[model samples]
Target chain A: MSEPISGKSLHGHLDTMVLAVLDKSEAHGFEVWKRLEAQAKGGLKLKEGSLYPALYRLETAGLLTARKEEDDSSRRGPRRRIYKITRKGKRRLDQGRQEWQHFVSVVECVIGAPA
Target chain B: MQDLRVHVEKAVRPVVADQGTKLRMREELYSHLLEVFEEERATGDDEAAAILRANDRLGDPAALTAELQATASRVSWYEGAIDRIVHRQDETEIGHACRLASRYLLAIVPLIIVVVPTVWIIQTLIGSTQKSFLDLVSDSLWFGVPFGVFATAQVFFFTIIAHRMLRQFDKPSWRPRSIGGVFGLCAVSTVFLLVSSFALFSILTGNPRATYELMMPKWLIASSLMPFVMTGFVLARRREIERLEPWSSLEIADET
Candidate 1:
């Protein structure tokens, strides 16, 4: 697991991380939660309120598409809405990554934030 | 992905409260989860552990969705209340519409039956002093093919409306086609009878008033006295009626 990134690390870089996660395919709310958790090695705690709102905002931004499916109650579970990344989403993810990397370099060169 | 479908199918199959909505919700979640799995795979973790780790990080799927129970409860309560209000409104509106439509059809059919045929009959009775039945029929055919089409239209309409109205009463939902069919049918019937003779045409048209007047003018009297008729139709197909009135509170059992 990578060292925990600060909440500061998360502020400008969430789109990058989310795109990085969804890059492989579509993901629902839970997948986004899990991937984000794993990105920070379970350290970036995103409340559902924040995570979902962000996902929704991204969706409205033409980066993600959310769809609901019938989740039969498990022999003992419930139902949920799944989200997917579109082509525009992939492009944005790539752009976000490049931007994050540039921002990281600029910060490292000027502010000298620890890696 | 397929595994999630199986999970979703289980959630939907045996029937939970609000099962239809839950099932729809499950499919949406499954698509999202499948994407997560793909992302997990793409990160190039140890393939063997990736799904496990992803699942582990995801916490409990059921618990994740428990958030929906509150939403579901609220939505269901809203749905229930709305169902009643909606159904009541629908019944009032549809009932009013049905009554108005029936009244219009009744009056129009009689007017049609009497007027169209009487034009022909009066022509024949007046015997060439004025415009004749053949003149009107033939003149229309000048542009309209003069098949005595209009008189036929009257009869065809009358017969079909009588039949279709009976059917509409028998079934809760009805299409405009069911009623419009009377127009062409009565047209044909009128043409056929008018071809026979003046007396036969009058006989076929029957009573103009019968076609026009309401059998039961008072919905208050009729509706109050015969609410059971509406109840019977609604109860017989409870599921469908419920769907139509999503806000209805009636527990009319679906005919599974």
Candidate 2:
């Protein structure tokens, strides 16, 4: 066998997971962090520093754009900068999808010995 | 429509900058969420809660804005260019006035170079031996007459440009009262540059008392240094003066 089987190990794969979630719909900083936290399934965690930096990099690469907007939940309307995916971001998400599929298939190819 | 706009704003307005994009996103998302809200309404839902739920379903505002911004970059770069194009009447007027003033000065200044020297040589050669006030008057008037006339024309033209510039700003009436100040500045500087340039030429060509030379070269001191220094002043101040006033005509609170 050339691989090991693990149910959930998404922490190291935060970028892919974060992007996959975004591929479904646009989200804010807190929403994205919360969604990724939930999807961890007990095996993934994202630090604010890590998640924010990844967001910033994706933004700088023409894959994302950002602007300030009022969050309305504000007792006082502090600015919240929101990000959105571009066409390039969607293509990147598609490529991420393909990679994840390949990775899952590679693992599935080698992990069997009667259950 | 009001509820739809608010709901759409909550979902999409945070990300988009354009009125068209905001309206479009509002309509599209509202149509989709309207169905979901109606389902709750049919189940005896409260109006406010159903509307709130519809907005919630649209998802994170920050995420939406960011997505739109990202998409903006991918959209044709011309979209941003449209926002930058000047549409104000004041901008167009100022632009036109600047072009006219520039062309007028360019043509007149060269004319000054032509007419000034021809008159100077003729008057200098034909002068009386007398040094009386009338003779001095004639010497300079015959020579300085054309030069003085041209300078006067230049001052009037300078006043016109400065007055137009003053109009562009949305200040108190006191702003235009300073038009005379600009004219005074240009006039004084013209004198200083001319005197210094002529002093240099007088020293170089040996004190204006040397052998009488009828014809001077094209690159003589008055023509070269006078225009050069004066032009440096104009070119240096052109951009700053043009932008000295703010684009908006919004009035400010009076402190006086």
CA lDDT of every candidate? 0.50, 0.51
* Candidate 2 residue A27 C-alpha distance from true site, Å: 2.1
Alpha-carbon shift of residue B189 in model 1 (angstroms): 30
- Assess candidate 1 and give its TM-score to the true structure: 0.33
Distance from true location, Cα of A60 in model 1, Å: 1.3
Question: Per-residue lDDT tens digits of candidate 1, residues A54-98?
Answer: 564576578888765564654222245567888898888878878
Give the per-residue lDDT digits (tens) of candidate 2, residues A37-81. 576554443223234546655776777777755546532222345
Query: i-RMS, every candidate?
Result: 7.2, 13.4
The CAPRI quality class of candidate 2 comes to incorrect
TM-scores for candidates 1 onward, in order: 0.33, 0.30
Worst 10 residues of 2 chain B by lDDT: B247-256
Give the worst 10-residue stretch by lDDT in candidate 2 chain A.
Answer: A1-10
Per-residue accuracy of model 1 over B172-213 as CA lDDT, tens digit each: 444333445434444444444333433333344565344334
Predicted candidate 1: interface RMSD? 7.2
Give the best candidate by lDDT.
2
For each candidate, what's the DockQ?
A: 0.09, 0.02
The list of candidate 2 runs beyond 4 A from truth reads A1-12, A71-73, A113-115, B1-256
Which candidate number maximizes DockQ? 1
